[model samples]
Target: MKNNLLLGITGSIAASKTEKLYNSLKDQYNIKFVSTSEGLKYLDDNFKINNNIISSWDNETGSPHIELSRWADKFVIYPATANFISKLNNGISDDILSATALMYKDSIYIAPAMHEEMYINEVTQENILELSKKHIFCGPKYGKLDIGDEGLGRLLEPDELINIIEKTKEKIIVTSGPTFENIDLVRGITNSSSGKQGRAIAYELLSKGYDVIYIHSDLINPVPHARNITYSSSDDLYQSILKNIKDVKKIYMTSAVSDFIPEKFNKKMSRESGELFLKLSPNIDIIKTIKSQYKDIKVIGFSAQLDDNLNFEKINTKNCDYLVINNLKDNYFGSDNNKIFIIDRDKLIYESSVENKNIIAQHIVKNTTS
Candidate 1:
């Protein structure tokens, strides 16, 4: 399905670039060209947008500002002028573009374009930072400026804008780090899993415009663009996945969930008081359970083993769409590097040389998705 894209153009010398931007994106998206009154001045008289422009609050159909705000899947302001940025950050909606921008409910793509001085001014910089919390930025690449002066505040090429706004987006789940199993108030069990591989996968997915939910341990820092959820125990991880399971297209089970859980002690155990005895019980088979319940959801299970021997039974038992094997003997427990074997039901789909986790992550995504 084509994405519903709303392009909000504003007063800037770079506004003239929207003519080419429109043609490149017209077919990929169901777009509406909305311009501030000043932006229209930069456009040619015979430009296609002259007939399609929606600049007023009211039209034959009713309130366009309200309609367009809700209609768009993504709102992009190409060549957003400094005045437009200030108006939006300050919540002034005297014009249609400002009104719709204030009313937008989803993530917006703001491509700022102006003179270098205006772009670097403390007020404009602060406004951009304030909006960065909820909005995505394309670029005012460092290149030629409007008045034959060059620094920053140059608009990105039309093709670059189209590339960013047209990419297909889907929600994915990535579980990372080691899951802890509590034994006492002061003691718990967790593996040396570093969470680097999962973080790398989430990073790669985010760069490709996927809506990534990174369910990880606090052992690793959160990926900047991903929605992060931290889990401490196997149950915590299970509940986190369950909470975000809806609408997710894929699940990457990369966290090292404890195999055996220790009986919980209400109070911290003391070494000087008595000899300690810990009783172990089997933990939840998270992957197996999720696959059994949501047979339609694609679940990729990760297993850390002591050897490189192929294990098809585990994959068959879990009913995973794909299985990734990590060899612990290679010292991958807490390392930034990894060597992996990707498998389907019975065949090895891909095997990688020991490499950095980021490169391994890219290969993992490439092969599994293909």
Candidate 2:
């Protein structure tokens, strides 16, 4: 049987593209469309999909919202407007699309289109972050918007949407945040990693239908829809990996693991004893150990350093299939934006300009995985 697909169209200029999207999916899917009243204005007159389209509550009988929400195997909101997204998040079921979305419990794929400024507004972003927990999003790709203005609010192309909605799914592990080595009960050493990058990776993976196990430190929040595991020290992280390694296909080792662990004292050190000497020992080499023990599992290592050059030797030493590098010289620690380089053991494969961590993640995952 063909997959059931419900495409919700809202009031955006990109709704004109809905006919193309419908025609693209008709062969592979049992296609149905539900458009907000305003959405009907922008749709092309050439649309045969009007026969299958539901425009208002009165047009359909006996709770169409509930029926549509339950019927679709894949539910998408294409050309989702900022207003519609806000309404969906706040439970304002004032229209057909909003009502159906509110009734839909499964992950809804949202493709947004608006001005770049509105797309990037703090309110919209907050709504997106919150809703992403139980939904998927393809793009507002960077391109021409309405009125010839160009930025990142363009709707994704038909093929891009098809690829995302039908992409092969996999199980993978993603580690985030900084590992802390406790010196005593009161003091510890850790890096400045805020876990934003890893969160972005997990979010992207979730959107692509990857089953993600997210290992993160308590200092950062967890990615929704991922199986979140919290770790403190490097040893704790390694143990978490060991416990969850069964049937895992890949590991994105993005956490900033502490290189050295301080010797722990059973008793808390008083301020008077601060002058005493201490010993530091090298922490566990997690990636190397995992690669050695489970040779089939692909481990993607991450390195953050002040040097601009890619270190092929470091990647070789760790046995990572790909090493993602971020230059700390740019002073981007804990920031939501990043520039990155992806290197194999032999040479650099990809480099990204400074952008949001989510965008950076898409480049990294696409290159390394492909």
Candidate 3:
């Protein structure tokens, strides 16, 4: 039997997006729609009706709100407005949606959407925090919003919401982007990595219902789903991982951490323009450090090499479970396509053809888990 999913729509500009959300998940589950009185105004009139579309509590049937609450296996409020959140937090049961929320004891998911200012309001934050104790809070992600403004409070896409609702409790850590090593106030040493592959991997894990803790540099592309910890230098990345890896089951060390850093850093930009020399010092090997302490955690490391063939004998596993080797000759630094060899401690396991980073990410997850 298909799981019954009751989608509760609230008044927000993002209410219009529910049509797309419905279309995306209609086949996967048995869906029923309900909208608040104000929510109904923003929703498209042409939205296809499936089982029941309830706008009000008034009905010939005895207590439609209670009946619907009991019918659903899961209840979701997408594009949940500030007003709706406030009502839900305050135990307001005047409306059918709030009534259903009060009655339902099982899983309830909320995806909030509103103006950035409204979202950041103290009262709104308090309400959301209280509600989060029970219900699953998906996102009001940072992105473009309805009024041509950009910040947090944009509704997460339908696919992202589906991932959140179906996600598992297994914790995974993903490190991404190039770690900067400051030489002077204005200059730094970093790699050409754009962090696209790492972000793709994080999203892939999320889509498969894995809880991801993403530790990334500020310069990289943003990943919307996971809890993020930002790092600037290699030491910062190393410390962040050590601090956050308490219960992590798996680690994806994808960041291109600088191998060397200037022994002495100039506090300000250098003014003397004579021939300048820098003493370089080797940074800590993050993968080796993590595996040394947590031997049981499955670790995945990335090697960007110049050679097409990966010499497994020369590569240091350092207790890493999987190694993803890609050739710099293939020009995968900032590109969408990637060709990689998946290697284990023993031998070459799988070699992937040049394909979309997202597809490669899917393969990596599948192979690693299998």
Q: What is the C-alpha lDDT of each candidate?
A: 0.83, 0.84, 0.82
lDDT (10s digit) by residue, model 3, range 1-370: 7999999999898988998988888887898887888888887766734435687867536897888899999899988999988998899988888898889888588888998799878788778767766777777765678769865577888988887787566899999999988888778888888897888788677655677788999897445446778999999999999899898999999999898988655576556876778889888778888889898899999898897676565346456888998887885699978989998988888899988786788788888875
- Candidate 2, residues 22-116, lDDT tens digits: the string is 88889989988898888888987757344567878886789999999999999988889999989988999988889999999889989888998
Models 1 onward score TM values of 0.64, 0.79, 0.67
Instruction: Name the regions of candidate 3 deviating beyond 4 angstroms.
Output: 1-5, 9-32, 35-50, 56-74, 77-167, 314-317
Winner by lDDT between candidate 3 and candidate 2: 2
Clashing pairs in 2: none
Worst 10 residues of 3 by lDDT: 44-53
| Clashing residue pairs found in predicted model 3 | none
Ten consecutive residues with minimal summed lDDT in candidate 1?
Answer: 218-227
lDDT of 1 by residue, 252-285 (tens): 9999899998999999888787888899999879
Candidate closest to the true structure, highest lDDT: 2
Off by over 4 Å in 2: 1-3, 12-14, 48-52, 70-73, 81-92, 102-107, 110-156, 203-209, 221-228, 266-269, 272-274, 335-341, 351-362
In model 2, what is the error at residue 195, expressed in angstroms? 3.7
- Say which prediction, candidate 1 or candidate 2, comes out ahead on lDDT: 2
